[model samples]
Target chain A: MKRLVQALRNVERHYLLLLAPLLVFVVAIAIYPLLFSVSISFFKYRLTDPTQTKTFLGLANYITAFQDEQVRKALANTLVFVFGTVTTELTVGLGLALLLSAETRLMQFIRSWLLMPMAIPPLVVGLVWRSLYNVDFGVIPYYLKLLGFDLGRGPLGESATAMAAVILVDLWEWSPLLMVIFLAGLKSLPSEPYEAARVDGANRWQRFIHITLPLLQPVFLVGLLLRTMQSFKVFDIIYATTAGGPGTTTTVLNYHIYTVGMTFFNMGYAAALANILLVVVAILSILYVMVLEQRQL
Target chain B: MHRKSSRLAFLALLMILALLATQCAAPPAQQPAAPAAPAGEEASQAPAAAEKPFAGTELVLASMTDQYVAAFQYLIPLFEEETGIKVTLDPLGYVDLYQKLTADFVGHTGNYDLMTVDIVWTGEYAANGYTLPLDDFMERDKDQLALDDIMPVSWTLGEWEGKHWAYPLAGYANVLNYRKDVFAEKGLEPPKTQEQLLEYAKMLNDPENDFYGIALLGAKGPAVAQDYMVFVQQHGSSILDENGKPAINTPKNVEILEFFGKLFDYAPPGATDYWWDQRETAFRSGKVAMMEGWSIARAGYENPEISSVVGKVDIALAPVAEGMEPKYGFGGWGIGINADSENAEAAWEFIKWLTSPEIQKEWIRHDGAPIRRSTLEDPELNQEYPWFPVLLESFEKGDGDYRPRIPEYSIIQDALGTTVNAYLVGEMTAQEALDQAQAQVEAALK
Candidate 1:
């Protein structure tokens, strides 16, 4: 017994032993749910109906997902939301990062002030925007009316503008995060390259395009990856604001999964929908990593 | 070789520890039994004798954070004092409450001793055995409960398959609320027919001036479906036929949808995006001249702090189709004991005290919707809520089953809600939308 105890103590001296708890936790919480969801995706399961046996349907659920018109629409909307929020955020974030990059007191103050929206919770942002877009008493519509914009029943009330309105909320809440990341990326860029570019008579736009942007590719990739994934899974803001309303224009894939899983209790179909989303996100992530790796090379 | 064996042993130890920890953290296999009333206790015992039965017992009630729940909070102290039982109110939003209640019931967690059930959930909850049938308890205390005093329509909401699974707490009948001042100024009486409603709406609509004829629930999901049902039922149509088959694409339903589409023109620009709160806000803010809303919102209209149309608003039965009988929308919350609850008897005691006649009379003063016939007919309550008589009349004619109390109603509502919103927004014609909804609901039912 003493020999065994001594041997166990010696084995614990390895640093990998310290990681066992974290590894076990990840397996239990993360990997287990993922595996369970994947398995359930192959069955016809309804959580609310206890009498219905969880019959194995093989790939039928996945096939049904491909044929579902609502799923298709949700996928299209998710793509639009992801592309819309990420590109706009990048452009707006890059501009703000450049503007605030200068060493000045006002810039520092403005930088700090810009982060206020980021500090606010996303759900709270949705509620604030909902109030701001209220036609009867919202401050935004009141000003737009004063400015003669003919907002014709606030922005969120019209399908033509609801998706854009939701995207703008996402931009307001998340653009600051990207801006801070880009600012750090900018500060970390070697100053010698910018000085060399200026010596060669490069213009401000030219220097930004040639030196700053190329050097910031990795940070841009990280921002794109994070924002795309998060924007695809956006349920809170849409739930708070439109609830995917005005003719399902803003019903993204995650919202569809929620309606199916929670409202309808079609657990198998919801699982199938979830796994398809996982695949889409996984592919996007892999592409981002490959591009990042190539850029590093 | 020695190191590898020790490493394997250490890994095995870690696995055993994890399993042991999980087991330790799990809930006990059996819940503690509730304290029973003393044997040989006489039926004529004083109130204090009954109070000692459940002393020191705690119960958790899962409920929605609504005006009715606020009233419950106000009345809970009286119950605690009378029974000496501690009560914890777990208030959640409507959707959150449904999700949490289902999670607790599905897992048989017994985390909640009581739950607030929507009338529409009766079939689902009872069928799944999530809630305990209150018939035995009602039978045991029928005299004290005064079950017959509850309005038939209200009490019937708790009945499914000839079993009582819950007790009615609030009876909300959807009634038409109109601006009295505006109608008087325009020399128009409240519309009694569908055609007159449209005409009145057209006359009242002045969107350029931010005044709309009506406020419509255009938000996608249950709100739109519920609003559509109010129109559909008045037009002598139902989402499901007598045989429980999808009847949404019938001619009458189509006509109702077409008329509803036109009514949108007289509503606020984003009326299609409005929910209950938005519709109420629009009416209270005087943006809309009229709206069909639940009776619960009636009290809010009388509060000057949140309403600009307090003294200007009056309630009436929802406008009906010409030659059709008036049918109001019936919906509200019912309090039910969790079947897995260890403290069900104590929970029932709380429910009984909450719904008793004397407490219900006091509850109405705190903005609780009346479910009892006695409370509805009380002269003082009628004076305070001038619309009480109209509400009682509507309740007599109201049909809670209009939305289909079947377990499949949620899926049907989802299909109908999406399609109706699509039609209203011009994404599809009425025919196309109904056809699509019919197909979706049919597939869901299958």
Candidate 2:
């Protein structure tokens, strides 16, 4: 009993022992699922069939994914969504952050109100936007017609515009997160460089280009990495609104994975698709981290 | 200082343990007091109720959120009163219910004692041993249940591999719902043939007035697949050939697809994006003159809150091919005991009580879809639901198994749904889409 108490005392005194529970939790929840998913990707398993055992297929699932046209289309759509939402969000978010940089009463109020859209759950955002895009009773289409815009079955109903409509919903829900990040970045920026630029006869635009943007490179990379990763995994909005409809124009990679895994019960193939998504996200994250590190140096 | 900090840490741990102990002890005291009085009263009145074979047993039911399930909640208290079994109802959305049920069954968690199974899932569930056969239970309680009173079509829903896996709860017959007023003005009879229906559609189509002739399901996934099956069956073609092989690209199927494409021109402009709710909304909002809908939605057409076409609509069996006999689509839910359930006997008792003829009669009064032939024939029920007779006729003639009940139905649905949607959106011709679907479905089946 004395020896047991001494061992306990030693662990308590280490301080790092306090983190053991959290470490175990992370390993159990995160690392285990990741490893399990990777292992499942190497098999041919269908959840629906009880008689069939999981057959080991090596990299056959991955090879099939590369050859699958639907998967390729979904990958292309995912890239388009990530590029479209990230670029537009960064541009608009930077502008809003710049405008709200002024320390004033109304700007403060507007800054707080900008976060309302972000507060809404993504599924609810999808549902609300779906109603707003409805052709018959939707407020947007009604007013667009009144304003003489030829919508032609509304944006979501047409193959040509469904992707754009979905991107717009993502923009509405997520742009505010970028704006908040950029606002903090702008405030934390050194004013000494701007003062020096002005002394050198640099105008506001020149100062912003040379001084502000250079200083904000790390922040920009962080925002890009976060938004890019999120946009690639887009599912709930497409699910609630378009359901990958209008000829599969809005079927992003995550939605495709869901359909393969849940809808079709192709668990092994779905795991392969998921691992591919993880690789893409990891590469993007590493690239962003490298750029940020370079900027820090 | 080190000694004092260690003492503080020890005291905090003691406090947390004490708090948890208090919480663990609280529930039992609160639970027993509420049921004691009624239990005592019932004990004196009915010895069986007092003895309670399954007393303290709790049964959890996973169900899809429907009007019937909502009304069924009232009976839970009575069940608890008589059987001394606590019932927990977990109602989820249709898709979510299937996913949850699948996960629970696959994991063998025994989380759900009962599940409301879709008829289409009977084969998959039974083959996987996810559901228990109810034949033994039925035989034991034969006289009490009166299994013969259920509609024959309803009985077929529960039978897979020559055994009963579930008891029918709700049965729907797919019907063509049309604007009666529009048909009257055009001097049109409800068309009995697909060709006549298309001709009538062309005549009634008025885009300027925001009235489309038909509201076809063009949404990708199960919506389009289900709607397409109705047409495929009507054309005297099956998804699988006579040899039970993929025959989705048959000449008859191709003809139907081409005809469906032509019909799409007269449907609402965004019809390709519509699902079940959207299609029903199109009809109820008076945007479309006609649509193929299930019998379940017929009651909603007269509800003043959401419907603008009240008293202006009529129902009929879906039109068949020119020379073919008429057949309607059949679909609905059934309740089954989970094979992994620990309280199977208690769950079986609950199922018996829920499906009893007396409860079923009362059930229909509160928006429940009927599965019993006797309920449809009851004069009082007929007076309330005038469409019951038509529903019964459709039930007798309808083919419930039009959509294959195989384990591969989901994969087949995905392949065909995507192809059909592509054709509807003009991404491919009917032949190309059907060919592609045939190849994909055959590959999936293999």
TM-score for each of the candidates:
0.91, 0.89
Where model 2 places Cα greater than 4 Å from the true spot, the runs are A1-16, A290-297, B1-52
Leading candidate by TM-score: 1
lDDT of 1 at A195: 92
The residue-by-residue lDDT of candidate 2 on B232-335, one tens digit each, is 88887898878666688988899988888888888887777778778888999999888887787788888999899999999987888888877778888888
Candidate 1 local distance difference test against the native: 0.84
The CA lDDT of each predicted structure is 0.84, 0.82
| Residue pairs in candidate 2 whose N, alpha carbon or C atoms collide under 3 angstroms | none
Candidate 2: residue B258 lDDT (0-100): 87
TM-score of chain A of each: 0.90, 0.91
Residues B259-369, candidate 1: write the lDDT tens digits: 998999899876777877888888998998989888888988889999998789998988888998777778888899888887777788899889999999888888788
Native contacts kept, each candidate: 0.47, 0.40
DockQ of 1: 0.40
